[model samples]
Target chain A: MSIEVNNIHRIKPIASYIVVKVLEETKTTSRGILLPNSKESPQKGEIISVGPGKKSESGQLKEIDLKQGQVVVFGEYAGTLIAQDESSKYLLIKEEDVYGTYE
Target chain B: MSIEVNNIHRIKPIASYIVVKVLEETKTTSRGILLPNSKESPQKGEIISVGPGKKSESGQLKEIDLKQGQVVVFGEYAGTLIAQDESSKYLLIKEEDVYGTYE
Candidate 1:
């Protein structure tokens, strides 16, 4: 693992959960207007740590398809938010909460 | 397919989407207090129509694991809401938006 991952391992996700470092909220709209604390559902973030995949009916561990370092979009209120500090915040979401990943 | 499914076919989902019929909102809380228009996410609904599947990176169709008639929990604002009529309302959400299914 890399140093960045090591840093993120402080709060490892369990089960089918993943830790996501929230991106800086866009303060300005496309029209150049300021908007604070947008309530949009689909928010983007970078994946930190992924947990072991959920068990199947037959007790098989199906691995998650997502990878760490990938930027993904999910429902804003989908997961439990953890504020590491005053400036940094992370979200612990299930793998299924992720809608799509961006390149 | 059953008659119920045929009726739901009028609004067949495409791609990785699924049609969910919103359950009646609980008018009262456990304390018998009225709460209307709750803003919480992860609401429960019954699955109606499901899409064929989503195209993978290799352009293969990946079928959704959910089945019809299953009630699912999802972020309230995760999907586009469509009012079928005065009383019936549905949501069009991607397969990944579903958090879990209840028996």
Candidate 2:
């Protein structure tokens, strides 16, 4: 608790929220094509902590939602950039911001 | 338009929906991980086309749900696999399947 309380990189996620670290950066082409070949394989991020789940329109809890330690893909256009531990981070994107979770 | 109208990879997406082509594959390591050293740069996908946005519970349309030609990242656990033009593809992931769109 003390460790995370001090480390910005380490955060205590609220219910219905997720903690993810950027793992890769992708390179895009002039026509908005991401060259299959980037400078290298893009970085990968890990889901550290997770919020419980989102409420559905009918007011019931949504499904499993996001989980801790799951590798996720996100819409680059979504999310707001924030600085944590003096490093750039993003947060609170809608569940839609999450794409795939690799196994 | 004509090209997409014919080619399966070349799809005509509806407004508010998107058509994406997978460009890379991500490989995760043990302990719930993505090696980052995938066989190659993970395949990239292009938003070939899109569909009309989903309506909100209030009946208004949602934000730019998804667009054509936007390279996207998705959730490993989300989306149903479908075959278009007899090739493997994914679809209608509730707009939540999209992650980042590189610039």
TM-score for each of the candidates: 0.48, 0.39
Tell me how each candidate scores on DockQ against the true complex: 0.04, 0.04
Alpha-carbon interface RMSD for all candidates, in angstroms: 13.8, 12.2
lDDT by residue for model 2 (B1-103), tens = 0011133443223224454556545465456676665333333466655545544433355566456667777654443222222333434344556666665
Query: Where does model 2 exceed 4 Å of error?
Result: A1-6, A9-11, A26-44, A85-90, B1-103
Task: List the candidate 1 regions with Cα displacement exceeding 4 Å.
Answer: A1-7, A33-40, B1-61, B64-92, B95-103
Looking at model 1 chain B, which ten-residue stretch has the lowest summed lDDT?
Answer: B1-10
- Predicted candidate 1 versus true structure: per-residue lDDT over B11-88, tens digit per residue: 545457787888866757889987665556467889877767765434456999988899988876677543233445
lDDT of each: 0.66, 0.47
lDDT of 2 by residue, A9-34 (tens): 55655535665666544343223443
Model no. 2, DockQ: 0.04
Candidate 1 local lDDT, residue B91: 60
Q: Candidate 2, after superposition: displacement of residue B36 in Å?
A: 43
